[model samples]
Target: MSQEKLEKIEKAGFVLKPDSPEIRPNYERVREAFESRGIEVLLAERSARMIGEKGMPFERMCVESDFLVSLGGDGTLLSLVRRSYAWHKPVLGINAGNLGFLADVTIEEVETFLDQLFSGEYRIDHRLMIAGHIRKASGAKIEFFALNDVVISSPVTSKMVIVNAAIDGERFNSYRGDGLIISTPTGSTAYNLAAGGPVVYPLTKAFILTPVLAHSLTNQRPLVVPADFRIELDTEKYEAVATIDGQERYDLEEGDVVTIGGAKEGARLLHRKERNYFSVLRDKLHWGERNW
Candidate 1:
């Protein structure tokens, strides 16, 4: 109720993925809490569609908001982070699914978390992002950004693709598989982890290269590279598709190239309290824990 407390957060925005019927009650609870603190709340298009309410565009939600809340799992946060990266807004992820890395805050803790937020008890964790582009054989190009990873895969077409990767114009590897994952440190925990890639520290400045169902047995392991390196993947055997943050996709043909690099700006994430990295791994992933 204090003036300073009210001033701590002026304008807030929420983006809810899936926009399901079950999430409405919890959404109202969080909205009322924000309004009680004198914070102006905005909803994204998906959230707007559910309540017969009009919401601002996703890009405007990023630019206009003092802070943004993501209500869903990690995938939802990834979508939010990618869209909000240009505005460099801080995001708080209210996990609506299983245990998540970025969406660490639980729905049950939203009330307490807001109190901690207003009290200056939270810390901001900045995570790196990756930008990529696809250049067709005809010279046309399209660009995209991803907070998690850029995946080049043959998820369709009923055939595996041969993808050749290069680093800074030098040939790196000739991989024949479903595809390859070029992930930021934040994304190292997502598809990258499932593909046998290393679990990089979220704060690290690095990119991970992990092959998906690689055909060759030798010398086909995941590689970690410095952030400064530029990576390119070109396919010439079968059709491939470039997917950004699992949201956007582009078809890739023979001789098409996709270039990836560290983005100019990173994502700023808000966490209510300090959490140990190793402990998070143990709790979220059951890392280093034995069932026996």
Candidate 2:
């Protein structure tokens, strides 16, 4: 949980779901709602072009706005947060898709949320982010950031991968399976949950290493470590792909090393003051429900 309150939100930058022109009407309605509250709306170039409106550069939008908004599902919110990370502007996600973990606010609730925002009756959550890099065998490097988890998996479905793990410069274990998920607490409910990893509290400062479908007879389970510790993984003999937040990917050769650690600064998310994590879990995961 973050104790930081937003400064007066005079202007807000918005990025809509990509490749969807049908979302224009919803964007208009939300823009009007914000304008009615005396808040200016700035749209990103690509998003505005999709809706047939003039827009500014993304960098400029980030610089000029007090905060940012994502008008889609959790994926859109994730993209916005990662792109505007250098700005450190707080973000609000208005859900235009299914019920989402991060985009908690719905379109119908935008007006009410705006009222709450102006009244200083909102909360901002600071969630952990992953700062990672891949060192290629050729001595080149690729850097990326993720709000969820970093996954290293085999390129072919029939082949399994052997990922050797090291922590803080010490060899630890080798995961021989489909792949491995290096997840932050914020990603515990994503692929991590489906692979039997624990649902750690989002604010917990920890890294979760969960192997997917291990080929070992001995006991192999998810491991949680302090976020400050560095984790290094390399595919021993198999070709692999490294995915960040399930959006971006990079090919990995046999000696390439993938390094992951907690970012210095986390992401800030704006939400209703009454939002509850346990309630979300119950609703989203259908926990404690009798299926007669």
Candidate 3:
């Protein structure tokens, strides 16, 4: 192997999602492939547990690893992206589920993917992130970041909630609805799309505000905002909750305020050579040539 090729392969450390049964077997196969060639393998804590790994902190595994691999669907890829952002590591996604926009590489492609990766045949794309700071009138503050979206909504069975949103400290709009989604361009295809938001290009530098099942017909559409603006939502008069990436949740009380903006750091994602956004859309949504 060439000096640069060996350097690239030797410098990589892998991070895999633990829940998938396929990951353990695939991990072993990949481990053997690398070990046979004298390359090192680093595993995330949760993944280590699944593979019977012991004697290392999970965070340390990520910090030491150069390339992290997420071995599941889009959600797994999202979690890995957040971890990579926190650790400043780049991530590769291997899809094992349906609608895997992020995790596009299939199991059959793993070996070839790794080879291309070491040979510098792939490209890395950085996706924008959103950070939110929530405060209550009583003086408590909480901070969170998301690769997908930050959602603010009322508890199940609760009445419609009212929110006053401001962009760049100026009054943007007051919404009377079930909830609101503040999504990154990468997330425009996720929950935002289901909520009627436009499918923005992944590389677009913009934010989307999509209302969920609004009570009023006039408030039915989604709003796209500039990525650099600061967005604030005042829920001081309503009962609500806040969520990030559909994983973390926080309760909202009267007089509580939530602020969201573009994050200084973003996620670096590795894309396979054959992956295409329009191709995925056409295949997943069945958008072409109807026989009926």
Candidate 4:
């Protein structure tokens, strides 16, 4: 939860869905709306190139703008968040695709939302992010951050992956399954949900460890731990790949160690002050609906 209101949003940076030219009209319309409110709109280079407009570099846009906007689906928003994490700017997601869990604001609501935004009636959420690294056998390290989860899964679907888990340097359990998802509370409704993991509130500070298709007699289940504890995972048998936020991937060798923990700063998300998380869950997941 955010306690302070935004201090007069003047300039906003926009990033559109990749390779989608059909969204140019939507982009123009939204850009007009923001301009009408006296907000200077800065388009990212890639998105501008896709839409045939002049644009600035992404780093420059992030630096000059008061906040960032993602005009696409949840996937687009995820990409924007991860890429702009270094800038530490608040992100606003405009939904143009289906199943908009992270990108909740609809196209129709842009005008009204902008009004609320200017009037300081918007909410900014601090969602936990994953700061992780992969230590290779040759002592090289690859570092990355994720707003969702870090998944360790086998490349071959037929072979089960054996992942050894340790908490703070202490060996705990071994997960022999299709894969393992170490998700944040904000990502509980994604792959974690499909794998039978609980839907945790996005504001909660916790790490969710959910196993996908476990092949064990003990019947392994999803485990939620405090964000402070560091988790280490490695596979000894079959080769595995570690995926960050479902967007980036790194091949893991037998001796490579993957370490995951909460990021120092969480991602700041801008939303409607009146938006309800449970209502979104019900609407998206049909929680209380029953077919007659």
Candidate 5:
């Protein structure tokens, strides 16, 4: 941590989810408490629809603030990260979901957490992101960014497609499956986990490739690769689509080459004093021995 970074966080911003009924009151209470103590708050306008309550006026808030605190589940936290692409604000998540690998605090700890935050007792971890480029044979291309996995699959399409996987210009494998997933370390616990990929920790600098419902059982397990290596997907079938963090999607044509790799930018995630990766995993995954 640079001194400049530390100073940047001393004056923090806040982004809250206003849609979750269970989370709305807590958000308001936390906001009031923090504001009463002289902390700056920046609320996301979309929260109004999400919480079924009128959110803070967007015009009154400035996007370029210090750091941002996200009040919701992992999904809500991801939304803040995406919205902060240009702002590049550090984000802290408060867990309101069943499993909150990304969300670090609980609603009950908001005030104390804020106190510790102002006291400079917390740390920020830089989490890697995936950069995806959609290329068309006609010289048109669109590039996007994500803090989670990039999925290219049929999901519910009527037919299976073949995708040739390449890493750093070398052929890796050919997959005959419903789709393929290229996930960041932060995403290993998300859709990648449900698809049977390993739960990579925050410190890992790697990307994961998991095949979705491959036609063959022999090559179904997920593979992890170095973060900087360029990954390409060559498909022989049309109608394939690519999604970023399940928030954005695009269509893929036959022979379209999609490249994915570590993003130049990343999310600055904040963690509380009592929070650690192993602790979160143990609680979220129920990793301890069973009481048989």
Candidate 6:
């Protein structure tokens, strides 16, 4: 990052979830590595005793730290990003699980990356996020922020849902499907892609709406709109749920309306300067491999 764009980082926030015994020792080793460089590091939340002392909660740690390091899979990093986006904290992902799409770094490589991190050999990717506001029939209001995607589906796994979606208050499309996905460019490869949505470039500023298993409306494909477009979703008939990043879920009764749009703040993902989106995609997906 350029000098002006980079914030002075002294204390690093660690987001380690589940507090497992096997990962504890590695966590301590990483913490010691950070502290050795005169950078104070704290766990984002309390952990297993094997990792030693309990660190502060996520909110406190985020506010106190110069930046954050997520030690888990993509799901864990997404949760951390959603909570810490308000602080605009740049987050580094250390993959401790399988198929870490967002958590792109391995535990073994983080030490080397830390040296480059403090030496100004990194870049910050400002990825856009989405916000979902729900107005229930009982006058209750709920709001959520998601770094990946917000999904709405039927309570029963086998049942299909009737969803009416409008863009900017204009009539758009209605679907009879299992669910719908409102994703950001950063989330194009998530549920959106699984449901046949286009794979948008991570840097693109757009909103993608993809319906899951639409009935009758075979033409109801994923819709990509400008980031500023306001999307309204009305679920009728079946009991449904609004799922945020697959972590937080809220039950939606009949007649509930959900408003989704671009969040005021986006997640800041930190990466080594040499890391390229296409290169990562190719390496992870085996794009150039031959079919023997």
Q: lDDT ranking from best to worst? A: 4, 2, 1, 6, 3, 5
Residue 91, candidate 4: C-alpha displacement in angstroms: 0.1
RMSD of each: 3.6, 0.9, 3.5, 0.9, 2.8, 1.9
List, residue by residue over 67-97, the lDDT tens digit for candidate 6.
8887777877898898787788888888886
Give the per-residue Cα lDDT of candidate 5 at 46: 70
Ranked candidates (TM-score, high to low)? 4, 2, 6, 1, 3, 5
TM-score of each model, paired residue for residue:
0.92, 0.98, 0.90, 0.98, 0.88, 0.94
Which lDDT tens digits does candidate 2 get at residues 14-87? 99999999999999999999999999999999999999999999999999999999999989998898889999
Candidates' C-alpha lDDT: 0.83, 0.93, 0.77, 0.93, 0.77, 0.82
Model 5 lDDT per residue over 214-262, tens place: 9986867799989999998877855777888998888778867898888
Query: Per-residue lDDT tens digits of candidate 1, residues 1-292?
Result: 1112222488888998675757777778888888888889899886788766688888788778898998888888888888777777888898877768888888788888878887887778877888888889999999888888998889685478788999999996888887899999999988999989999999788999999988777768899998889998899867788889888889998978899998887788888666566787889887788889
Model 6 residue 224 CA deviation (Å) reads 0.6
How much lDDT does candidate 5 score?
0.77
Please list the residue runs of candidate 3 whose C-alpha ends up more than 4 Å from where it truly belongs after superposition.
1-7, 18-22, 34-38, 217-219, 289-291
Least accurate stretch of 10 residues (summed lDDT) in model 3?
A: 1-10
After superposition, the stretches of candidate 6 with alpha carbons farther than 4 Å from their true spots are: 1-4, 48-52
Cα lDDT of model 3 by residue, 30-122, tens digit: 677666655677766667777676525667767666677777778888877775677767777877656577888877777787777766777
Residue 64 in candidate 3, Cα distance off native in Å: 1.0
Candidate 5: worst-modelled 10 consecutive residues by lDDT = 1-10
The residue-by-residue lDDT of candidate 4 on 127-232, one tens digit each, is 9999999999999999999998899999887579999999999999999989999999999999999999999999899999999999889989999999999999
Better of 1 and 5 by lDDT: 1
When summed lDDT is taken over every stretch of 10 residues in candidate 1, the lowest stretch is 1-10
lDDT of 1 at 260: 92
Residue pairs with clashing backbones, model 6: none
**Candidates 2 and 6 compared by lDDT, better number:** 2
